[model samples]
Target: MTSTPPDDFDAVVGAAPSAVTTPTLEHTAEHAAEPRGSRFDDWWARTVYTPARQRLWYWGAPLAVTLLAAVLRLWNLGNPHVLVFDETFYVKDSYTLMHLGYEASWPADADTKFNAGDTDIFTSAPSFVAHPPFGKWMISLGLAVFGAGNSVGWRISTAIVGILAVVLVMLIARRLFRSTLVATIAGLLMAVDGHAIVMSRVALLDGSVMFLALLAFGCLLLDRGWFQRRLDAKVARRRLAGGPADWGPTLWWRPWLLTAAVLLGLCSGVKWSGLYFLAFFAVYVVVVDAVARRRAGIPFWISASILKQGPATFLLMVPLALVTYIATWTGWLVTSGGYYRHWAQTDGQPWAGALNWVPLWFQNLWHYQTAMYGYSINLHVPHPYQANPLTWLFMIRPTSMYYAGSSLGQNGCASANCSSAITSIGNPLIWWAAAACAFYLVYRLARYREWKVGLILMGLAAGYLPWLLYTGRTVFQFYTIAFEPYLILGLAFVISLIIGTRTDAAWRRKRGLLVTAIFLAFVLAISVFFYPLWTGQQVPFWYWQLHIWLPSWR
Candidate 1:
């Protein structure tokens, strides 16, 4: 008789079960002598045969967590009603981009005038912006819908993207760990984390980069599974034809990879740091393909993947990404008044000979891009909240985006002094714990060689490691928002290990569950404590001081 599969079986093994089969003793013996074409048959079987009832949790759980994220990001979004931190640049630029088709130069008193409802203070002359226009275009959508002077309008698009990011994290975690509970834990952490909260609530380009990079990561994860299934089928066909598995077939039709390329291009269009993700993940894809081929018993897996398939993958991803990146400048490209829009025709020399055929507009764009790159790399201006990337993961020196003080009788203040502030600080327990978990994951990846662990670490590396080269370039801890999702995912992975398996001793299972519950409760409690600071909520000056655990945070 065949037995029922355990509900938590996938949780323990980190993958779906192979197809279940009930066969006679004689039939089982006969099949044991035959060669199987591929190892993924069981995975396909389990997937195809999954109960309809179990599938509801797949969408249901993630959507619930995303609802929590929406509430946190959208509540009182217009509080303080002023340009906070870098919003002085992004929000004003977005307002002008909506009106003028590109970022236009604003007068010295533009913020004061714009805040006082004089929203039309920009000139037609282009501003030399450090970042690209895609993120600003997104912000322009919100400004268009709600009017430019409304603070909620200034930040609604980012809030929505932030909510969607929480759902993506849940879905990706579900795929990686094969556990809905673990996935929910990851989403909850991101939902309540103060850094994610502040980044979502403010109008900044980094939030767009974070969401796009994460969406690209999700696409890549989907591609990994799709590639494996297709490779298995092809390998099975070859083995059935009595052929040697010398090299795997090159599979070119990858929709997820193509989607990822476009997303990464748009990401880079928002902020150039997004290119680091594309570069890192491209290498990761080639490595994963080699391993997949090796697992399918290909004798020449390494050379076949590196030499034969690598070029094909590059052709599929890089050129498409470049095209997409250029397409993001449509507004600037078509318009005449953008910064350096006619440089090649006037101030700069255009290419001669064969390259002379290139359009003056295209050459002008190239010149403008190079200038933007030079400015970004060489920037060393000092600011009070500028943080070293080395201390980012620890939440030391969190950036203060906005702050206002009130006397006892002003603005509903009840204490001798009151404070309302927006601090981009992560919850202390969650951040410190996630940091410790990330270090442990590095060891776990080395010891066990789990692809999921490597993938999570790669996400962290893509968002973070590149910044180390520019420590002198005036970066801030708030930039950590880009990789903060991966940190929560890493934390979730460790939590899975702590929760143990249903197969473990009853006492062990109970202890694990109890511990996880207590930890989550504390995380929730800390989120409540810090929510006031994360938003610009007024509190007693001493109470606000209590929330600052470290001197550096102030």
Candidate 2:
């Protein structure tokens, strides 16, 4: 049966006709012609078309899930008391940055002093930190508010960003699937995932990177809608004016894309690895632009998209990201005391001659970036916990951030030699199932040409594939935290497929719903079982052993 289009499909495209438009729904002939008998098909169409219900659930449901996520992250956030894993570097750096406006070098025993509740452990000299300073600045914001002496202050920002990430995943899933129910499932999955929970509670740069990258991805999704609206409006205007409407109108101003550029820049600011996202998104948006023009009947859509429009889009996105990235170094840029801040003056570098006209601060900033790049590429130092990128998906090795063994009488240990640990493991069910689902998504994307599956795949590729090139380097599985949401999203998308559209045969829909519920229940149960490990709660030795399913997990 041919189901009806949403009543407001045209209204969404033409709501701001002067600013945006779409060709008729008929323009997407291939997608429109696909048969839709499944219950999912009917529900998705209604959710997409019913503006009132969409508005109600989109923010309302996702925000509720985010609240649940926040409670989980914030509760017992200060438990570890002492610095854990990379927090030894980041939390102290944040404390220093808060007081001095730049990261300062610490004495060899800085960790000892700081962990003992003595916060003044820094020296007068600047620290030669590898990553950019903005992430530390965010940590410093929390420290400044809550007093750097406390563990909660060190972790609060990460927790907040982590919760916000859940909201972003929900919104992005909603936009991709056009179903609030699926979006809620994605958000809830993220909310409870052990990896996300652990990252949130620890003062690490990766959580901030995850939040910014996810935010940028959300902006790109919004931009897709924004661009489509403009495309439809242009076609509508031309036809009404009795002008040729075969070719789509050119879109020069894309504020949402610009917004995405800024967020992507911030993602890079958190970690240079975010550069991959910038590269992926730049290509993704331009291709999307070209496809929009093609669907609107442009005879030269390829030339129009690649030539006429591509360069302008690149100019708007790439350079803006560069500027935003530079802006993130504002503290280091203005200060004369950061390490290598005087490289141009001291080293007499040859590049200085060409850049002599530029301000000394900027020249030195360039020199610092060069030094950072050198340090990054050549970093092959061995780490005990470092796992190859190949095993990150399988989670063959999870980094242990904090671990302690307790006797029967100490620290509320209920058994002989109980254990408390914070292990950066994902929810096993979610990670294992999603890893399997990702393969299916690849087939769906290629064979069925499913756009949503493509989005999930692109995210995973941008976040995961880049690591494959650096496996010889000292990368860790914790880095997977950056792309874990996309994996969850792929899993949710498949589950939505299984739930089949409301128009499908009753038995098929019932079975699909039952299977989906069982899968989610198992995921939640795994999360509960692993929660103690995620939050550093002590559990019986045997219980911990049972949670460790694979031998490598040890």
Candidate 3:
């Protein structure tokens, strides 16, 4: 006895009653054939497409989930007062960058001094920083508002970015599934996930990278809808005017696409890996445009997209992104004390001939970027927590950001042994389920050609696939934070599949709902079980060991 097709499946492929009906382009064709005033169309508009209801969910759901995220991220944010993990680099860099307009050198005892409220230990000498300044700049905002010596100031920006990321996941899920319930589930998963919580509570660049990339993705989703509406309207006008409809008009004004490009540029400003998203999504946009044109009955859709619209789209996106990326270097550029700021005028060879007119500052910036790239790719120093990208999906080795073991009568230890630790391990149930769901999504996308699944996979690809090439590099599982949102989204999609439509037989719906509720309950329970480890809460040694089901997790 098969269950009815889910409402989300109908929303994506078009409404169908039979459980065995495979979604195909024919559903789109049938949808196009329906009259504007048809009973089904009117009913859909009145119920599912109600503007008032959409507006409420659009504003209300994101805020509700963001508040939950805020509490999770901001509570006890300053615990373990010393810098955790790479916060040693970012938090200090942020303080110096705030004062000197460039990352400055600090003494070997800087961490000890800084933690003891001696925050003014940075010197005027420039430090050779690997990543761009944007993320550190974001961290500086919190430092400026709250004192730099305050631990909360070190992480407040990332915590806020994490909260905003939850909202983005909800908004993006809503756009993809067109269901408030699915959107809320996605947001709730992001809010409660240990990986997200740990990343937010620390001063690290990856969370900022995740937030910017996710925001760019949301912008692209908006662009997809906007492009479709504009295409339809222009095609209708052309047919009404009796003009040839062999090729659709080239759309030069894509506001959302421009916005996505800028956001992606800022994402790259946080980390060079963000360029992968820009490259992947640019190709995705072209493909989506070709499909949209083909569906509008344009015979030369592929050729038109490639030849006519492609160059225009590239100009609208790439150049603006380049500018935005350069804008992020304004502080580095304006400061003469930055490392390699005068390379072209001193040790570096200046360009000859037509390019000799290039500014020395731009040449020096280019030289600095090359040096950064070289350092980044060649970094292979072995570390205890450096997990292979192959093990990242399984989370075999989560990074231990901070850990302090106490024997009895030390640091408030009541038990024989107490441990306060912050581990960047994801909730096992959520992480494993997401990993499994991702594989299923790949198969589903191939079989049904669902654009939504493809889009989600594209995000995962942008965040995860790039690291597969760098297996030899010293990387940690915490890097998965960059792609965790897509993981949550994939999991949410599978959940929707489980909770079949209301139109299913009463028994089927009841079973489906029961299964979904139980799974979510387990997920939440696992999150609670691991919260102490994720947040550095003190717990007995055995209790901490209990959360570590696998030896590698230690």
Over the stretch 25-128, how does candidate 3's per-residue lDDT look in tens digits? Answer: 99868756643322333454466455566565556666787888899899998998998889999999999888888999999989989998899988999999
- For model 3, what is the alpha-carbon lDDT of residue 421? 97
Residue-level lDDT tens digits of model 2 in 17-63: 13355767676685456553555546656676666665655557777
Per-residue lDDT value at 406 in model 1: 98
Worst 10 residues of 2 by lDDT: 8-17
Per-candidate TM vs. native? 0.91, 0.88, 0.91
Candidate 2 deviant stretches above 4 angstroms: 1-63, 235-249, 350-353
Q: Please report, as a residue range, the 10-residue window in candidate 3 with the lowest summed lDDT.
A: 1-10
Global lDDT of each candidate: 0.87, 0.82, 0.86
Candidate 2 displacement at residue 354 in angstroms: 3.9
What's the distance in Å from true for residue 223, model 2?
Answer: 1.1
